[model samples]
Target: MINQDFLSRIRRKNNWTQEDMAKIIGVSRPTFIALEKGIGSPTLDQIKKLADKLGCESQDILSEDIVDEEKYREVLLETIRYGAATDGKITKTKLAKLIYLNDFAWYYQHLESMTGAKYRRLKLGPVPNIYFSKVEELINEGVLNLEIKKDGSQMISLSRAGQMLKPNLLKTEEKKLIKNISQKWQGKRTEEIVKFTHEQLPYKICRDGEVIPYELITQQDPEYVY
Candidate 1:
């Protein structure tokens, strides 16, 4: 059930009325009431918007599992390190799918995502909404670089390999999974991985642009995963 009290408290704390809450959530007043009364469940997108407005992680409103952003950044760096080509660059789209596979496949096994970040279905595949902005942030920090190719694809690479944090934030298990995913997808064409993720149950059942529920992966067959 959605935490009705949290919504009410946050709304009140901000001196906002029910109408204001509805506006922020992009829903009508009655629908907002239904959500508040536990008669309806909030969509992941709505939860994400509310969390953004309040300057908090989406899990803060939905669950106790907070998103570990630093660890997520580390995972991205490690994915690039393990999965990049000999020149140490990975296509932006491919990198997104690789991280999605790592996170969702881990969730399939452990009942939790590696980053606790929410992913939304997009034309290419399931990707966290923040993936682009986060990549941009890394580029700004001189931790990663981006190049636009003649084919219109964006390629990313580490600006300085040594700039990656020491005593990595990723746990052993997490790093292992990323390495395994990297090896398996190595040399695979971008089209092949795109087809693979597009066929997964979580992506298949969701509408275009919908947030994919992590629970759906539980129903996916083992071999079909990642």
Candidate 2:
């Protein structure tokens, strides 16, 4: 079940029109429109072609219709922790890349749109506002720190509270979700899985190698307990 809304959301967040995306995927505009509308299903070959053009995993596109939000949030938090723990400080680009791998495009777009006053990109690039909002909220809650540099680059790292909260946040339910995701996608490339999942977790790698993030809409459903 390909999600029409998810497809539209991804297209809009990137500021890409249907026609623009169609051109990129080497498909006729009508064909692309059909895909988005869920009137037709793309073959595996078409999925691969689209993934290559989008620089994302096949799972991202495939899973759009059946995303489980609670599972997604746990994955996201874990990814953040992993990124933060890697070098004791999470750079915005690294966090962004991780988020991209998780296929949170709307959130990524929000980060791009809202990171205006707090941070700037090293290059002329879109900042992800949703990421910033989460970061900002976490910062206000004493879960993270936002370090702005004179050179316009930003550094984000977990706070003491964030560090403490990380392990506790991973309950048995989350662990199962993580295990399932890992088992399903193990040995597969992130981009490939992301594209295949395609519900809310679709991802696109920016030109600078940063993974553009998006929102996990399924997370918003209250019944979606991990």
Candidate 3:
């Protein structure tokens, strides 16, 4: 239970299935599945072995504060709310870039990312692997609607603008940063924002499918940061 989110996230990151994790952790498949679902947990020895195989400390796997899922969910919805076009929809590609900009830009200033999500460089730009699953989860929960346009671009929008919730995990400073970045790109074409992100130092230097390190963003000029 302590690292339920971590177990889920790390397993996904490695492209491992429950059976694979079960074997890696020396547990039965059903037990690992229960651990993933937060129904139970692995023994300390199992956790230690799994941590060793993953080449990380037990604390790294057990630490709940490493990433904030609540903050991530709130940020995703808030980014959708702020960056959507006047028609109240944002192209999925552009939405992802905007969120990446917000995260890295915040890290540039505070030396810590807003949500602590790991972002990798992809064809669209820099984005977290979790972004896609989180958006899909939201859509499944009826909080978001995904529409495919005639051009084949996926558009994301809130089920209702009035459904916005107060963010307990996000700060005023964080909200302001999201708003400012969203404002800068709101009227621009998705191509423009995608190009801007692609041109950023973080994106330019990182190889395809590689995680863009936050430290690299610190080396960028202030003008190109966003």
Candidate 4:
């Protein structure tokens, strides 16, 4: 069920009238009223817009009862799966860079991260330690397999025993950006991708193991900015 009271409270707290909120969310005033009156459900995009307007996380705007850990896990696994599907195989470095790009791309456009993972400076680029841990957990549970090649290259492959991703887990915009990121970087050599990242403003400014803030995306050099 939708938390109409919470939505109404947040809207009111922002000092926005029904019309103002509706316009910001790109919905008709009557439709916004219907949503706040519990007569209609809000789609993921609407919820995201509301959260942005209200200056809160989408999960916070929707309901405080539901945690986002599972959502994060799903996104992490799906990103790897999508990267593998993009190239028939994906190296660990490439997969990490793809996820990094997706997050930055989404942030640049939406002013909010699609997956709120903290990225840190690494040899390749801004890599998320949380993603590494989550991947390890999935591997331990037989959801994915990691292979080490003779040349010391590592790759990730999906295991057949794992549950398939739910079709509606990601919003259309999110999926589109992920696919675009994968396709853009799929065939590039690991070193080339790393060089690209190194030239980007975020990776250049951050020290090793430091958290790379989303704000840094704005400092991108025009020559190679995303």
Model 3 ranges off by over 4 Å: 1-66
What would the per-residue lDDT of candidate 4 be over residues 53-126, giving only the tens digit for each residue?
76888887554422134555666566666667443566878777777787787777766666666688887788
Candidate 1: residue 188 lDDT (0-100): 79
Q: Each prediction's Cα lDDT score? A: 0.81, 0.49, 0.83, 0.71
Cα displacement (Å) at residue 132, model 3: 0.5
Q: For residues 1-226, could you state the per-residue lDDT of candidate 2 as single tens digits? A: 4444455555654678999877766789999898887777667777677677668788866643232333333444565565453345655655554444334222232222111111212242323445555666667888777888897767777777766764443446434444443334443443443334332222223234343333332343322111
Best by lDDT: 3
Candidate 2: TM-score? 0.36
User: 1-226 in candidate 3: lDDT tens per residue?
Assistant: 4534556666755778889999998988888888887787678888898889979888777752345666788998888888888989999999999888898999899887787788888998888877888888889888999899898999999986425666777799999999999988898999999899888888899899988887899999999888
lDDT of 2 at 221: 34
Higher-ranked by lDDT: 2 or 3 = 3
Give TM-scores for every candidate, taking all chains together and pairing residue i with residue i. 0.72, 0.36, 0.73, 0.65
List residue ranges in candidate 1 displaced over 4 A: 1-60, 63-66, 161-164
Lowest lDDT sum, 10 consecutive residues, model 4, at 62-71
**Clash totals in order:** 0, 47, 0, 0
**Candidates sorted by lDDT, descending order?**
3, 1, 4, 2
Error of 3 at 11 (Å): 18
Q: Is candidate 1 or candidate 3 better by lDDT?
A: 3
Best model number under TM-score: 3
Candidate 1, 87-203: lDDT as tens digits:
888899999999999989898988767776689899999998668877999898888989999999899998874245553667889899999998888777788889999999999
